[model samples]
Target chain A: SQTIHQWPATLVQPVGSPLSLECTVEGTSNPNLYWYRQAAGRGLQLLFYSVGIGQISSEVPQNLSASRPQDRQFILSSKKLLLSDSGFYLCAYEGADTQYFGPGTRLTVL
Target chain B: AQSVTQPDIHITVSEGASLELRCNYSYGATPYLFWYVQSPGQGLQLLLKYFSGDTLVQGIKGFEAEFKRSQSSFNLRKPSVHWSDAAEYFCAVAPSSGSARQLTFGSGTQLTVLP
Candidate 1:
């Protein structure tokens, strides 16, 4: 079975600090990866999605960006974090018709 | 652009009672619909989806949703409610023609199960 993993399950960063969140999928190759953010008491918003390595399509204009260096590894990065950047970050991969999600990372910017 | 709407922000249901949550969507063509459940501080879990064939789709955790084309609605329901079922439910939609599988989610409905 395929499984997704995300690093830094919980993070606390100061304002204007750099941010990097990593996501990796095991047991699957060339899978579509996505980054989503959910604010407190709100639904998820799609941020970035990658169909292949070095190819990323941004859904919303934001301070963050995504990169897929390997077939199974995806990274979300930010040069400088903002207070509004604090939220629950989710990593998902497309499987057949549905998408499977990772455990997620909760980042708190103070 | 595709969009989803979950009418209720929060719902309270007594244990063992029947439950129903309303969802509506708008899209240009045939749309792919999905329902996901999220526990506090947890990732969203896919409950059910509607791609084609059946209008009524059965999903995990004993949840079912019916897609009504004329009404432009896909409402989720359960025969009897359980305390464990208390969580936030989200309705999402994606365009069938697009290669991108990104989903547009609604505001979500928070379920509160009464004991």
Candidate 2:
């Protein structure tokens, strides 16, 4: 079974601050990875997805960007965080037609 | 484009009672269907999925979902509900044979189990 690990389970940042969240997958190689954001009382929104190293696709244009430096490592970053960016961010890896999710990161922008 | 619809935004059921959550989907062909549960401030946990073969799929935590191709629905059901089952449930669908394996999720149904 593949395991996904996301760091900084909870984050608190000020408006206009830079942001970085990391996601790493184990027991899988060259897997499809995705980033989704869920706001309060809202559905999950696809932010970005990566097929392989150095390849990233943005689903919704925003202040956030994604990078896949390694086959199993994906990073979501933003130069300046917006108050609307505050939400629960999730990382997922596709395996055997199934996308498994990580614990997720909760971001609070003040 | 594939889409999922969970009609019930919120449902309240008594503990030990039977429960059912409705889900409908739209796609060009038979898509992969999935059910996931999320607790407050937590990530989604996969409950069950249906790719092919049997239309009825069993999942973790005593949950099961039956896929009806004729009706384009995949409804989750449990014979006996527990207080721990109180959480938000989401229905999702993905293309069966596409390079883009992204899932389209519904708005979600919040389940509340009364004591």
Candidate 3:
């Protein structure tokens, strides 16, 4: 019964403001974590993935960055948010043959 | 490089009608394929996956897909569509090597069921 949790289901941030979105996994350890963004009515775009603590691979280049502080904790952060950074962010955990997604965080940069 | 392509951006069908969504992938080897459905305000739900052996695989919500190696395609099919089936569908592929779990997703297809 592995479950992934993400906080701040919805957030409104001003441009140039700092951003932080957290994700944690329960019932699973040493799991791979991923961050994805989806625009309205569009497909998901992978942003970052962490295989272990302190190790992160970024798929796209942007103001956003991801960190794995603990075995089951991942954080997506940005020092200065931009208007283009607004989207629905989804955190996912890699399973044996499938991937499980968290509830997700919707950030609106105003 | 590995990639996935879902040609149809949107599809509409009547309830109880047969449905098919086309998916194509470009990979270096016999890739692992999967289909996912996303309902409004919900996370992606795994429908099915194909690794080897059988080309055809069954999934939840009465959905199925077939892998055609020669065509480099994996198309999703359903004998009868339901009203609840109206949602976004994504086709994905994973390389056999590397993480063996990293997936490349298609742009996704929006399925609209007409009652």
Candidate with the greatest TM-score versus the true structure: 1
Query: Model 1: DockQ against the native?
Result: 0.76
User: Interface RMSD of candidate 3?
Assistant: 1.9
lDDT of each: 0.93, 0.94, 0.91
Give, for candidate 3 chain B, the lowest lDDT window spanning 10 residues.
B94-103
- Candidates sorted by lDDT, best first: 2, 1, 3
Ranking by DockQ: 1, 2, 3
Candidate 3 lDDT tens digits, A5-103: 899899999999999999999998889889999887557888999889999999989999999999999999999999999999999998885678898
Clashes of each: 0, 0, 0
Checking candidate 3 for backbone clashes, the offending pairs are none
TM-score of chain A of 3: 0.97
Q: Please give, as one word, the docking class of candidate 2.
A: medium
* Candidate 3: Cα lDDT at B15: 97
TM-score of chain A of 2: 0.98
Task: Give the TM-score of each candidate.
Answer: 0.98, 0.97, 0.96
In terms of lDDT, the best-performing candidate is 2
Q: How does model 3 score on DockQ?
A: 0.58
